[model samples]
Target: MLIAQISDIHIREDGQRCCGWVDTAPFLAKAVDKLNALRPSPSAVVVTGDLVDSGSPAEYARLHALLAPLAMPYYLVVGNHDRREPLRAAFPDHAHLRSGPFVQYTIDELPVRLVVLDTNIPGQHAGELCGERLDWLERRLAEQPNRPTAIFMHHPPFKTGNIPLDRLDLSGKERLAAIVSKFRNIHGVFCGHLHRAIQARFAGTIAMTCPSTAHQVHLSLGESSIMAFDMEPPACQLHWWDGHSLVTHTAFIERFDGPFSVQTGERIEIRTDSIHGRAP
Candidate 1:
């Protein structure tokens, strides 16, 4: 099974742009197109939060339209920038979003069981997993201890060395780590909030963050480094599960140069007409 993951879309309503210049809608549309055009199409797409620039119904509506072209099933997780009620209202057909008080659920149909966690703390830039949420996760993990599972959330429980980003790290991470350490079935913990791709060892498993489909957080590692964003190449992560283990690849959204033949130095003609637009 192939699963595509995109994060931090930060879509704004029509005629509006994120951070005064980045029109996140088009970037997401490109991402959708890229995912749809994949060779071995993904079974599902998991969007790891920041679905909009603001927690507004209008923005959610815009997001709804942008994601409509996805060829496969897609799931959403709550991030700091998303409003649970507005998101639920936007996609009433996504019953999983309304499963409980939080936007957390499980996708048991796939080879790799997906357990989505809600870590959003409304009106705040940081993320948290309260006792209730953590307990719910523990119970969920205990239910299928032998299943090959993956955890999805917005905030990463481990530090990424980016000082400013680390400051907004997930609260209750210690307890989360403790709980995750007991689960041998957990293959990976995927998160987003960082706006950049990063990985680290966590609780005997791999925890990683996906890059944004729009602006990316600048890679500045130091105690005094400030928070900032840059117009990096937008991309999505593809996780391929071949019955036993998962392999991940980063697929860029924009069309790039040629994939020339390495041995003969010949230009290989491939389709480049799909994603012609560049990220702003």
Candidate 2:
């Protein structure tokens, strides 16, 4: 089984560029192309969050239109930048897009049950999975104790080490960790909102943050630091489940340079000289 994860699209309704210069549409289109051409196509695509920059209806509509070319079914979660109503309204036909208010639900049809969490706290930079949501997750996790489960959420429940970003991350992380540690079924936890790909060990599971298909968060390792972005090649994450284990790989949207080859059973030589045409 295979699932592709793409995050932080930040699409705009008026078609204006997000963050002043990066046009997300083209990058998203390219990402779709990469997914489509994947050797063994993903069974589904899970967009972690930040579907649109402004929580606007038009932006959601635009996002809907942009991802139409994807060949497989796609699931979604909510992020701080997203509005619940607009998102649910935009994709009412989506299976887990609930009617009440929250977008938390599970997709159990696949080999691995996908537990989608709604961590978006209204009008807040940080995310909150209230007691209600946590209870829901606990119940779901208890249902199939042995089945492999992968968490799909917006704000990660652990510190990312980026000071400013961590400040706006998910709240009640201790409670979340306790719940996750109890559930041995959870194989991995995938998240967005950081805009950069990062990985950490949490609650006996591998928690990974997917890179954005739009832009990347400038890498700052300091515990106290400012936020910035760069034009690093946008990419997505691919998870492969071979009935025994799950492995994830990064799929870049930008076409990399030629995939050169090196022959085996041959002696290679360094041919370059320092600055001049002739050897020293």
Candidate 3:
């Protein structure tokens, strides 16, 4: 089973560009087409938030238009840039999101259980998993103690080393770690907020972030480095599970040259044309 994660689309309303610079809509369109063109499309696509730049109704409308072309079923979670009410209003058929004040739910149909968490604070860039949210998660994990489960959230519960982004990392991480450590069946935690691909070990499990379809955050490890954007190769992540091991791979959105295969011999050489396709 394969699952795709697309994050931080940042669709805007009217002619305004995200960050007043980048035209992110085309980036997202390219991402959508790329996913649809996969040989075996992913089982489901989970959009890890910042669905819109300002969380406005107009922007959500545009986002709806942009995502309408996706061939696979999709799920959404809220981020700091998202407003729940508008999002809920935009997609009323997403029953799980409407059931509670938070956009947390579980999908049991997939090969691995999917547990989504809501970490968006009403008016803050940083994240917080309050007692209530933690209690809910504890109960969810308790339900399936042995099932291979993956948690989804907007903000990663661990620091990512980018100083400015780290400042906006999730609060109450220790409490989260303690809960995660108790469940051996919990396979991984996937999230998106920093607009970059990141991975780290957290509470004995792998926690990873998906790169955005939009522009990426400039990579800088210096203490003085601020939040910035760069025109890098955009991409999405595809996760596969064969009932034994779960492997995640990145699929870049751009179309490069031929995917030719070469064989080793006394002298190995690059072959661009398909050997079998050519009439010999």
Best by TM-score: 1
Descending-TM-score candidate ranking: 1, 3, 2
Q: How much is the lDDT of residue 19 in candidate 3?
A: 93
Score every model by TM-score.
0.94, 0.91, 0.92
Top lDDT: which candidate number?
1
- Model 2 global lDDT (CA atoms, 0 to 1): 0.85
lDDT, candidate 3, at 189: 91
The CA lDDT of each predicted structure is 0.90, 0.85, 0.86
Tens digits of per-residue lDDT for model 3, 1-280: 7789999889898798999998888988999999887756677899998999998999998888888999988899899999999998888777888767788999998878999999999878899899888999999999999988889899998877789888897887789999999999877899999788899999989999999998898997869557898988888988777676568898888887655545433433444334322321
Error of 1 at 155 (Å): 0.4
Candidate 3 lDDT score at position 233? 87
Summarize candidate 1's per-residue lDDT along 26-116 as a digit string, tens digits. 8998999899988667888999999998989999998999999898999999899999999999999999999888999999988889999
Worst 10 residues of 3 by lDDT: 271-280
